[model samples]
Target: MTLAVFRSFPDFPPYGGEFEDLMPHLTVARDGTPAEMRAVEREVREHVPISMLITDVQLMCGSNALTA
Candidate 1:
């Protein structure tokens, strides 16, 4: 799996390398084909800058889908 890492908009407060304080980052995209990824890259390169507001965050494991 590959991660397209990006810095947060407006920036997050930095914590002097503290383990408990996680780096402020948002994973833009997960694993994808090289062609698909290149498309995204092209768009990003051509588009103007934008801000992303992240309200909620969640994490899940396992590749298979799970029912609610």
Candidate 2:
């Protein structure tokens, strides 16, 4: 199974958990090729979420950057 971590940034919620606020998320796509996996890993190391990796780096999906 792919390793996905959810790190907490700022501070952990009062609920209390192993992770803080920000988490290190990870996931392995069973259908993804070796090259794709490598790229995904890189994105994760850079703190990018899987969705962004898939859309921006892989370009497999549309990268719809929303405005605040």
Candidate 3:
């Protein structure tokens, strides 16, 4: 899927093609202060093992815009 996206938009490679392999992840928080980040980590650790069904995905790009 990543490769296909790269092919379609040669100018906008995933992560600017910086990484050799991509690891699936979920962003819990962004730009949080150190103390806030620690609090988030503690909260997340309380639910160490999370499970869910990902039935669909939406590709977003370009600064708060939904691309697809």
Candidate 4:
């Protein structure tokens, strides 16, 4: 699926071509302190093996909203 998106939008590369491989991940927090980050990690660990049904994808370019 990632490859298909990249192929479809060759001009807009993932992460602006910063990364060669794309992996499924979730950003728990940004610029968080060590203690704060650890707390979030512990909380996430409590709910291991999370699952969800993705029905739509949203693309954002800079501050512009682009729905896909």
Candidate 5:
């Protein structure tokens, strides 16, 4: 299993001296057969906390399904 984290900050300026908080995200991937990947996806969806939103998914280049 592999996990990736990403953070993004907007360019908009704040009213006060402080800038906006940075956004954080998490992405999980399991290198395996299609069936195994599906199983892992279901498990993660059920177990992971609700605060993190799995908004988008992009398979890595040469990755299992994307390459096929």
Candidate 6:
């Protein structure tokens, strides 16, 4: 399942979700290897649901940058 919107957690463990200048995005692929991620993306386009609800959230920093 996947969502195409931003989400936030009220509070997360360890650091309590207090990072600065943070933004959330829909996670398309969770695979470690780039090849595996690509394969998963293909499957996601075919089988993922149109809508999804996030239950629990774990905050983390990613290296990717968002562009306009």
Q: Write the per-residue lDDT of candidate 5 for residues 1-68, one digit (tens) a residue.
A: 11232213223222221535633435477378899889888988897674645666453432354445
Quote model 3's TM-score: 0.56
Arranged by lDDT with the best first, the candidates are 4, 3, 6, 5, 1, 2
> Candidates' TM-scores?
0.35, 0.28, 0.56, 0.64, 0.32, 0.33
Give Cα-based local distance difference scores for all models. 0.47, 0.42, 0.75, 0.75, 0.50, 0.50
Best by lDDT: 4
- For every model shown, the clashing-pair count is 0, 11, 0, 0, 0, 0
lDDT of 3 by residue, 1-68 (tens): 56766787799767767798986667788768999999999999999677777765555666655322
Per-residue lDDT of model 4, residues 1-68, tens digit only: 56678788899887778898788676667668899999999999998777777676555677444331
Best by TM-score: 4
Model 1 lDDT per residue over 1-68, tens place: 01111134223223322355354554455669999888887887675465667566443324442321
Count of backbone collisions in candidate 2: 11
In candidate 1, which residue ranges exceed 4 Å CA deviation? 1-26, 52-68
lDDT of 6 by residue, 1-68 (tens): 11221333333322343555444446765546888888878887896455657676444544442221
Ranking by TM-score: 4, 3, 1, 6, 5, 2
Worst 10 residues of 5 by lDDT: 1-10
Return whichever of 3 and 4 wins on TM-score.
4
* C-alpha positional error of residue 29 in candidate 2 after TM-score superposition, expressed in Å: 3.1
Question: Candidate 6: lDDT of 52?
Answer: 58
